[model samples]
Target: MIGRPLILTTLVVAVLAVAALFVVPRLGGATAEASDLNLEAQPRLGASDAPVQIVVFEDYLCPACGQFAETVFPRLEREFVETGDAALYHKNFVVIGPESERVAHVGECVFREDEAAFWEFKRVAYRSQEGLNERRALDLVSEYLPGVDAEAVRTCAAEDLALEAVRSDVGTAQALGLRGTPSVLVDGSEVTATYAAVRTAVEAALAAR
Candidate 1:
């Protein structure tokens, strides 16, 4: 019995030491990986059946996010997303803080009304980042999404559905241990945050799936 307890103690100490050395560093590395992954690119761009799936997490206020939207999104949409070769998804990390969260909520509200128009609203929102005002966002949404009722947009955005959607996106980022914007996930694996890196990952995912 004394030998058994001694052996048990030894095993416990070894396990704890191993955890301190290996598990802690791995956890920290995972966190850093997640922070590097978050970005604001739109998600699920191609057909549901499309082999490639890319999930982009981005913050509206991040300059890098702006660059990706302004420079890369259109090209991706035209070349890969529209052509059914690739699909992209969006997760709002809200790195700009409160305002970004508000914008994400509003965008989600717009998405609920009309998914097709949602992309247009996103395009316009990113374009108007400098002069973003919530009220103006509502107005711009109306202008861009012709058939969507602005009042409904406002109400939904301020209420449950859209709020939940935005929260869910944020939650997804947190769950992935991401701390920043411009994150891209290829086949559910976190990778680099650049457009080129994302494109290559998407292509590989497409080939695989």
Candidate 2:
């Protein structure tokens, strides 16, 4: 499911991330301890017993996040999430602006009705992120989630459901010392922000298990 534009940039991001590691501040020293893993806060996308956990923090408006969702995410789901090797918990980190939180709130509203809807919104919103703002965030939900109560989602989004949890996610990212969007912590260790690197880390975690 990797698109042409995404494929062109994945490796480039990988290379740059490796080079930037030293320059970027390493917050919690690259390891999120298992005891510190917060599964209760966000929507998790994998089985309970999965040996590895890929905690995702990203903004819907972030382009690097779109690239990750397009290129690395499918493979991760197929080889890890579906196979019960690793779990993914996508947390909201709205660095773009208030609009990012609005979109996240819509996702929260959808999650109340259907977990699947929330995931779908994440995908579609990212694909359709161009020119998106607080107002248009609701429009994307209406267009994409026809089956769900779009109006309710808009209401909840305006009210900002689970807004504290989004703040918590931001704190988690800060503790990890993240430098940018589309970052992952594989088994509590911060790897290069790329699917290939994450997959390799997951394999290592699996082998260790």
**C-alpha RMSD for every candidate:** 7.9, 11.4
Q: Estimate each model's TM-score.
A: 0.75, 0.81
lDDT of 2: 0.79
lDDT of 2 at 209: 71
- The residue-by-residue lDDT of candidate 2 on 137-204, one tens digit each, is 67877888878888787777778765676777778787767767887888788787787889899898
Candidate 1 residue lDDT tens string, 7-112: 9999999999988997675453223233343433233466865666567787776778878889877887787888888677777887777878878778878877
Model 1, position 87, has a per-residue lDDT of 71
* Candidate 1 Cα errors over 4 Å, as ranges: 1-43
Off by over 4 Å in 2: 1-29
Q: What is candidate 2's TM-score against the reference?
A: 0.81
Question: Model 1 misses residue 29 by how many Å?
Answer: 8.4
